[model samples]
Target: MAGIFIFSEDSALAKQLLTPALELKASLAQPITAITLSESDAEELAKLGADKVVVLTGGTWAEGFAEAIYSQISKAEGSILLVGGTLRGKHVAAYVAAKLNAGMTTDAKALKIANGKLLATRVLYAGLAVCEEEVALPAVATIRARTFLAPAPAPAAGVVETQSAEADSRITISEVIPTGDKGVDITAATKLVAVGRGFRRKEDLKLAEDLAGVLKAELACTRGIAEDEHWLPIERYIGISGQTVKPELYVAAGLSGQVQHMVGCRESKVIVAINTDERAPIFEAADYGIVGDMYEVLPLLTAALRK
Candidate 1:
C-alpha cells in the first residue's frame, strides 16, 4: 500500500515526524510507515500512529543503510519519504532522490500537504527570507530537528515487518568516533545559553555556566570562546565556521551579533541579547535586549532563577 515513509535511526526524530505523517494519513486515507533498525523502537513507532514499521539492520550507517532503504522502496508506487537533514543523512537522501528521479527539499523547517503533495517551507539567504515550494509525489525531504514536535502516542499499535538486509560488501566503515566524548551537541539543544569573547579571561566562563545551570540550557559559545579562548569544547561552538543551532530560546551574552554568528542562530525562536554596548549588532537581531555588563547581569539573573 502507498504510505508515508520516514527514514531515521533516531527514534525521537521518527516520533516527531509522526504527528505530520498521521495528519497526512488521515487526510489521504493512507498509512504511515517508519523505516528504522528493528528493535523496541519499532514497537514504539506503532504507538505513535504508524500503521507499519520496517526494521532494517546488518550494515554500518554508510555501508548498507542507504542501500537497504533504496532496495525496499524502489518497488513502491507514489509515496512520500522524509528524513533528518544531518550531514550524513543528506547523503542518503540525495542518493535515493537521484535514483528515483524524485524532487527534494533539504533543511526544511516546516512541512505540510496541499493539493495532494508535500509543501515545505525552508530558510534561505541566511534566514533573511522564507522559501515555500510543493514537492511532487514520490518525493523526499530532509527535515530539521526541532522543526516539528513529536506526536503523542496512539493507543493502537501498528504491525512490525522485520526485514534482513545484507551489508554492502563494497562499502565499509573506516572508523568511528564518539562525538559526545568531546562535549554537548549544541545542535540538539532546545534551549541554549551562549557566551562570546566579552569575558576577559576563560575563567569567567563560570558566570555563563551558572546561568546555564539555572536556565537548564545547553552551554554554547562563539568561535572565539571555543576556538581561540578554549573556554568550551569545539562541539559547543556555533557559527558559520562551527555548527548551526535552532534552539527555541537562545540567550546570548557578550556577543557582538556579527553576521557570521547570527547566521548560526538566526533560526532561534527567541534571541535574548545581554551586552553593555548599546549599539551592538546583537541588539538589532535579538527579540529582547539588555544594555548592561553581562558580568553583573548574569549574576543577578542566576540569583533570581536559582532554586
Candidate 2:
C-alpha cells in the first residue's frame, strides 16, 4: 500500500520530520511509516504517531543504509519521503532520490499536498527570495531542525518492525578524531546572541558573551566571526549557508544584517539589534533597534539583565 515515509539519522530531527509527515498523512490519507537506524528512535516514533516504524539494523554508518532505505520505500510504494536536513541526512536523502529517480527538495521550510502534488517552500538565491516547488509523486524532501515541533503522542501507538541492512563496505573506518570544540546546538536554542563583523577584535566577543550569559542564551555568530576570524566554531555560525534558527529572542550585535545573515534568524519571535550605523540592514529586520556601539550597548544590557 502507498504511504508517507520519514527517515532521519538524528532521533530528535526524525521526530520533528513527523510534524510535516503527519500533516501530509492528513491530506493524502496515507499511513505514516518512519525509518530510523536506532531501535530506541523507532519506539519513540511509533508512540508519537507513525503508523509503522521500520528499524534498519546492522548499518555501521547511517549514510550506508541509503540503498536499503530506498529499497524498503520502493517495495512499499511510498508516495512521499521526508528526510531530516542534516549534512549526513542530506547525503542519504540525495542518494535515495537518485535511486528512485524522484524529484528532491532540500532545506524545505514548509510542505503540503495540493492537487496530488507535493509542494515545498524554501529559500532561494542566498536567501534573497522565497519560492515554492511542486514535485510529482514519489517525491522526496529534506527538512531542517527546529522547522517544526514534534507532534504530540497519538491516541494509540503504531506498530514497530525491524529489518536487517548491511553497511556499504566501500569505505573502511579509520580513526575518529573529535574537533574538541563543545558547542551547543544553536538551532535548538530558545534565545541567541549573534555577533558579527562589528566587533573590533576577537577579545571584544567577551562583551557579547557576557550579554548571552546574563540572558541565559547561546552564543551565535555571523560567517565572518566563525570562518574568517576563527573567533567561534563553525557550528556557531548563522547565515544562508549556516544554521537557521527561530529563537524566542535574537540579539544581533555589531552585525550588518545582510540578507544572507538575516535569512537564518528572520523568523525569530523577537529581534533586537545593536549597531553603530543607523542604516544597517539589521535594523530593518529587527523588531527593536538601538543605534549605538555594541561594545557600549552589550555591557549596559548585560548589567541591566543581571540586576
Candidate 3:
C-alpha cells in the first residue's frame, strides 16, 4: 500500500505534522512515515503515531537532503507527502515536488483525502479569499507551524530507521552568524497584542507593550510598523508576507483591519480590536471592539487587568 509521509527539520513542527498524518493514515488506510533529521524527534514521532520513523543523518544542510527525501518516499510508494511550512522546509518541499512531478500546495490550513485525491484548504490573494485545491497523488503540501496540536502518544511506538544523506556540495559554508535574541515565537503565542500604523510615534508603542505585559502576551505589529517605521523587528510583523498566527486571544490596538493584515490572525480564537475609527475594517473581524483611541484605551485596559 502507498504510505503517507511527513518531514520537518524543526523537531516540534515534525511532531505536530503527525496529528494530520495520523488522520490521513486513518482515511487512506496507509501507514504513517515521519522523516526527521534528529534522533530525538524520530523517537518522539514514533511514539506520537508514526508507523515508521526515518532519521536522516550526516546532513549539515537540511535543504541538501531534498533528493534523499524524494528517494525515500518513492521507494515506499508514498501517495502523499506533508512538509512543514518553514522557509527551509519550503525549499525542500519544492525540490521534492519537482523531482516527483507532483502538484504542491503551500501554507495549507487543512488537508484531507477525498476520492483518492489530496484536498487542501488555504488562504489566497493576500488573505482576501480562501480556496480549496485538489491534487492527485502522489501529492505534496506544506503546513505552517501551530496549524495543529501534536496528538497524544500512540498506543504503540512505531518502527525507527536511520539513513545517511549527502549535504549539497555546491554551497560552501564559511561562517555561521546567529541572529541573537529575536523575541518569542509569536505564532506559538497563546495571546498576541498587535499594533499597526495607528500609533503616531514609535514611543507610543509603550502603551501596547504595557497591555501585553498585563495579558502575558507577545507584541506583534503590522508590516508598516516593522518594515517601514522600524518600531519592531520584522519577525514581529503579522501579514500575508509575514508570520501567520492563530493565538487564543488576539488584541489589535491602533491597527486598521486590512485584509492583508487580518489574513494572518483572522483564525485567532478571539480577536479584540481597539481603534478610534468605529468604521475600521478590524471591527468586522473582531469579536469585541472599542471605538476609542488606543493610546487612551490601552492604559485603562492594562490598568483594569492589573487591578
Candidate 4:
C-alpha cells in the first residue's frame, strides 16, 4: 500500500493538509502519515487521521531532513508522497522528488491511487482546462489548498517519532521581511474582507477596515486595488496567480468578482458581496449581496455588526 505523507511547517497547515489527505487516502484506500517539525505538532496532526506523525528537526535546505525522510521512504517503501502547494512545501517536494528520482505532479487538485500507481489532476491555462497525469516512477504530489475541508472527530491514535536530518550549508536565510501590516496574515485568517477597483479613493479603505474590524476579519484587496492604485500592498491581492484562500467567510466590497478573482476564493464557505452595480458577476457566487454605495453600506454594516 502507498504511504501518503502530508508535510506541514505549522499546526494550521497541518490542520489544512491532514483532513484532505485523509479523505483522499480513504478514497484511494491508502495509508496516511503526517510529517512536521515538532512533536507537539505531530501530536496535533495525529488527530486529523494521520496513522503516524514523524517530526523532523531542521531548517529549510537541511539535506539531513530530506535524508531522514528518504530513509523513512526506504523503510516504509511507500510509493506516493503528498505535500501542500505552498512555496515552501512545493519547493521541498520538488527537491525530495529529485533526490529520490521520483515523478512529481504539482498543484494537483485531486489525486487517486489506481492499479498501484498514482493518477493526479492538475489545472492548465490559468484554470481554463485540467489535465490528467500519471506518475510511474513512484510519485510525489503537492495538493492544492482549499480543495478539501478538515475531517471531523479526527483519526485514531497514531505513533510519533523524532528524526534528525543533515543540514545543507550552501545557503542561509539572513532575514525575513513579512508583507502586509504586522498583524495581518490574510491567507491564514478565517474571514477576509477584500476591496476592489469600484472603490473610488484610497481613503475609502477605512470603511472597509471598519467592516473588517467589526467582523473580526482580515483585510485583502484585488489586483487592481492593490497594484493599480496602490490602495493596498501587492501581497494583499487575491486572484489568479495570487494567494488562494478558503476562509470561513469572505466579504468582497466593490469587487466585480471576475473569474480570476473568484478562482482564488471559490472554496470559501460563505461569500458576501457589496457592489453598486447589481449586474456585477460577484453576485453569482455570493451567498448574500447588497447593491448600493459602499460608502453608505459599509459604515451601516460595520455599526450594525459592532452592535
Candidate 5:
C-alpha cells in the first residue's frame, strides 16, 4: 500500500485535507497515511480513514519536517506520495520531493495511480480548462483546494504512530496573520452578502451591511469596491486574482455582474442579485433577481426580515 500524507491545520476546513487523500487511496488501491502536528490531530485523522498517523516533534525544521515525512514514507512502502495544495503542503512537497529526487505536481485537481505510476490532473489557463499529467518518477504532489469532491470511504484500520525528526532543527513562528475575515472571511462563511460598483458611494455600503446583518451573512466586496473607492480591503476583493467562495447563499448588491466577477462565484448554491439594470449579466446566473435600486430594495428586505 502507498502512503499519502496530508498537510492539515486545526481549522474548520480540516476535513478538506482528507478529501484528496481518500481519493488518492481509492485511485491507487493503497492505504493512505496522514501526518499531522499533534496527537489530537492524529485522532481526527483517524476519523477520516487514514491508515496511519504520524506526529512530528515541536522543533522540527521545514527541511526537518520534510525529512520526517520522507522517513515515514521510506518505511510506509508506498511508491506515491500525495499532499494537499495548501501553502505548507506545497513547501513540504517541494522540499521532500527535491530531497528524495521525486517528480512533483502542484494544484492537482484530479489524481490517480495507473499501472503502478502516478497521474495527476490540474486546471490551467485561468481555470478555464484542465490538463492531465503523469509523473513518471516516484514523487510527491500538492493538490488544489476545494477540488476533491468527496472523502474516501471509511471503516479502515487506523494506526497511530509517533516519529521523531531526522535532523534537530530550529523553528520559530514569529507572526500569525489571518488572511480572510479580519472581521469575516467571506469565502469561509456559509452565507455572504456582496456589494459591487453599483453601490456608488461608500455611504451606500450600509445598505449592503444592513442586509447582511438581517440575513446573518458575512459581507464581501467586488474589485470596484476596493480599487475604485477604497471602501474595502484589497484582500476582500473576489475575482480571478482574489478570493473564491462557494457559499450556501451568495447575495450580490448593486453589482453589474461582469463576467470576470461572475466566474469567481459561479459555484454558489443560491445566488440572489439586486441591481437596477435588468440587462446585468448576473441575472443570467442568479437563481433570484430583483430589478430595482438597492437602496430602495435593501431597506424593504431588511424591514421584512426584522419583522
Candidate 6:
C-alpha cells in the first residue's frame, strides 16, 4: 500500500489513474484507494487493482469534490495522491493541495519511489526538456491523460467505502451544453486522425472526417486548425495547451508536426505522417511517411480501408 489516493470524476479516467496507483501500492506494500463521485460503474477499478474504493457522493464543483476527498486525506489514508491532468482534475488537485499545504505538480508523465522519496518526471521549457524532482510526502499531482497505460486488473476485490462529508458548493451548474458528436472522449480514443494546415480550408475537413469514419477513429486537429481556422472546436485541439492523446494508430495529415503539436501525440503506439514536405518534423517522429499532399493521400487511404 503506497498509500496513494487516485481520483477522477469519470470511471474511465479513474481507471486510468489506477494503473499508477496500483504500481505504487505494489512497490510500497500499501493499499491502493480510488475515489469517484460519478454514478458510473467503477467495479473495473477494483478489478484493475484498487484495494479500496471511496465512493464520494456530493457536489459537482471543485469545492464539493475537494471536501469529500479531503475528508479522507485528512484521515491519513494516503500521503501521495494522483489525479488526471484534465482541466477539472487540475482544479480539484490545486484545491486539495492548497488546503492541505501539500506539494503539488501537474502534467506529470512519470512517477516512482526513489531513495524512499516520490520522484516525479515532468516536461519543462515548453516540452523542450525533461526534469525529475523529489516531492515531500502528502503530495498531489495531475497526470496527463495517455501518460500511462491502464494496467491489467489484479485478482482481488476492492472494498467499497462510502465516506460522506458536508460539502459547500462554490460553482453552480446552470446548464450543460455538450459538444462533439456523440460526446466522444478523445483522450480515450484508441485510433485517431489528426488534421493540420495541409487542408486548404475548413470546408476540406470533410476529407479527414471521411478518413476517420472508415478508420473508426476520433477526429483531432492541431492548434491552428482549431484556434485560427475554427474548423474544429477547442476541445478537439491536440497539443500542450490542448488535450493529449495516445491512440494505437495516429494518422497525421497535412501537419508539419511542430514540437508543440507533437507533444500531445508522441506517446501514440504507431504514427503515420502524410505531408508534402519530406523534411517535416512529423515524419521524424512517425513510423511511416508518405511525402505527398494530404488531399491526394486521404482519398486513396480511405478508399483502401474499405477493401
Clashing pairs in 3: none
Backbone clashes (count) for model 1: 0
- Among these predictions, the greatest TM-score belongs to 2
Pairs that clash in candidate 2: none
TM-score of each: 0.79, 0.90, 0.89, 0.71, 0.72, 0.79
**Where is model 5 poorest over a 10-residue stretch in terms of lDDT?**
6-15
lDDT of 2: 0.91
Off by over 4 Å in 4: 20-33, 43-52, 58-76, 121-123, 128-134, 144-159, 178-192, 210-218, 227-230, 233-235, 246-251, 269-307
Across 61-113, the per-residue lDDT of candidate 1 in tens digits comes to 74257767776677655378888666666787888888778899887777778
Q: Give lDDT tens digits, candidate 2, residues 1-307.
A: 4899999998889999999999999899999999999988888899899999999898668888999999988999889999999988999999999998999999998999898999999889878899999989999999988789999999999999998997787977777666624656787799999999998899999999999999999999999999999999988888888888889999999999999998889889999999999999998999999999777788999999999
lDDT of 5 by residue, 9-112 (tens): 43323456677667667766667677776667677677767777777765534434776777777776556676665666677778778767788887776677
Candidate 5 TM-score versus the reference: 0.72
- Model 6 lDDT tens row, 134-225: 88777898897666778786888787767565667655678978776567788889999999998998789999999999999989999999
Q: Which stretches of candidate 5 lie over 4 Å from their true place?
A: 10-16, 60-64, 70-78, 97-105, 114-121, 131-139, 144-156, 166-173, 177-190, 223-230, 233-243, 256-263, 274-284, 288-307
Go through the candidates in order and give the clash count of each. 0, 0, 0, 2, 3, 4
lDDT of 3 by residue, 71-156 (tens): 99988889999999998899999999999999999999899989989999988888888899998999999998888889999999
lDDT (CA) per prediction: 0.81, 0.91, 0.91, 0.78, 0.73, 0.82
Q: Model 1: clashing residue pairs?
A: none
Model 2 clash tally?
A: 0
TM-score of model number 4? 0.71
